[model samples]
Target: MLYREDKKGNRISALGFGCMRLPQDDREKCGRLIDSALKSGINYFDTAFMYSGNEELVGSLLGRYDRGSYFLASKIPPALCFTKKDFERIFRIQLKRLGTDYIDYYLIHCLSDYSAWNRLCRMGIEDWIREKIESGAIRNIGFSYHGGTADFKKLIDSFDWDFAQVQYNYMDEFNQAGREGVEYAHSKGIPLIVMEPLRGGSLTGKLPQKALERLAADNQSAASLGLRWVLDKKEILCVLSGMNTEEQLSENTAIAESAAAGCLGEDEKERIEFIKSAIRESFVIGCTGCGYCQPCPNGVAIPACFEARNNFENGKNHPVFKMNPARRQYLHSTAVLGKSPMNASLCVKCGRCEKKCPQGLKIMSLLEETAEVMEPAWFMIPIKAYRMINSGKKR
Candidate 1:
């Protein structure tokens, strides 16, 4: 695999392994994937506290490998930290979860705006990080971001970061942190690691049919088209992909092996823009379905709700709501048939999920919109009645 140097001069693989979506049911499969990644020369692995049980899984898999052979990166959730003690508490928990004493590259999970960083500073995060780094408990310090370019620039200039991670892709060239944020980071010599290069798989498996056809016409694989687009930039230190299958691993590694900076020709650029247009035609919401905003206090299945809504909007067939597969999927997955409803309509406007979302989505407002479209009173009344009756039978 190709390599790039970080600010610390660590030779990170051009393709890093994202450990967020590892299979929970298949430990053996996950193990093999990590082993294959290491053998294929991928040294950087990224995970976070918000990714449930992911740190332990990654820790267990990497435990077998010698420490020096790979670099493990994890993040501290700012939302979970209110005091300086919380930082120590989470860091200790993270080290225990990973089964390692030191994290190679550590990040402030989804630092968001410049003001959030300032909040962290008030809570004594800087001194805490300094102590950890001095004690060899943390290697390099950085942050993952999900805010506008102005805040991103302010944050980058505020601190001497060793690296930063962002959600960057061809489709998101001018979105959160956009091109300007990336260029500013590069100007300051802050090496960048990219997450969601495939826009949570939307640019590949979920691409509109027209976009897929265009990719086929150009003899391009969907995964390669998206990945190579991000890797083409010299400013990118590593591009992270959450590969589950062996085929994904192989395809991604092959792309990383040859996708040098500025590899895209004008023709390829045009094809990408065409695909973008196709996507935007039917794209209803900007959600990437990352599930970072989760476990809603009100029992809302946020990501699944958004996914159903997106699928419905993107579908070519104009099926009636009662006969729609999207509505059916939403009903079943969100537990509309169960004792308690978990659909978008059930959202309580608690605003907790918004704090956790990496995309900085106005989730409460979006949920209101989703409920209006995906869960009409005429459609949900019968289901609610059935549940009321079924609830008695179970009791």
Candidate 2:
């Protein structure tokens, strides 16, 4: 498989086997996949404390092998940490879960904004991370981000990060932590790890018939085309895929070994651009986040509201949220964010935001609909319960 050298001069596989989607049902089945991946030259494995059973599955599957043979990456969930002691306790639990004494690459999970980063720092998380790195429990420190480019840059500059993972694909070049952020990280000597290369299988299986025809005309499988697109960027150190079946593992392994860097021919590039254009046309909301509609009089977090809607509609199966249960827990935990900025019911039919909107979105009507559908009683009850449970545990 192709490999890229990190800042430390260690060659990491261009394709990392993410354990969030390991084949389960039994330990033996899981081990075979892990064994096969390693035998086929996959040396990087990524899991998280929140991925249900994934840590144990990976630990059991690969623990018998020499630890030096592979690199392990996992995340520390910031939402679980209200204090420095919580960070220490969570790190210890993660190490035990992975059956490893040290993690090769450790990240602050899904950092969304500057506020979250400040919260972490206020809790002495930076000192805690430094201690872990100094103590040899963590080799490299970074964060996985799912926020705006401005916030991403703030976090990137806030700390000397070794590597950063972003949700990137052909369609999301302008979305959260897009291509600019990726390049920015690389420019700072931090390697980029790309997640959602396949857009949560939407680009592969859920493609419109016309898009499929365009790909077929080029004689490329949907998966290979999508993966090759991400690997086209020389700055991307690795692309992590949560493979679930043997066929997926085999296909991806083959692609990794043969795909050349920056090898997308003119036709391939044009086709991908066309596919991206088609995907954009399918979105109902035209929020490009120009911030024209900002300063909402009703205190509505319009951008954040749109993001949640977009995630629910377009990113339901995203690995960031789907593969890891912690994502769900974190989203639920937001209900207790010291009085949320604005709920769906707070829109109050104000037309002021509409006048400022570039896309002319009927702000009042949309908010009403969003509140009714997105904030249904069925969804809020569970989230409320989760916040209560988490709050009590902290107390």
Which lDDT tens digits does candidate 1 get at residues 191-233? 8999999999999999988998888888999899899999999
Among all candidates shown, the one with the greatest lDDT? 1
Per-candidate alpha-carbon RMSD to the true structure: 2.4, 10.3
lDDT of 1: 0.90
Models 1 onward score TM values of 0.94, 0.74
Alpha carbon lDDT of each predicted model: 0.90, 0.78
Query: What TM-score number comes out for model 2?
Result: 0.74
Q: In model 1, which regions exceed 4 Å deviation?
A: 316-322, 393-395
- The per-residue C-alpha lDDT of model 2 at residue 91 equals 91
Which pairs of residues collide in model 2? Answer: none
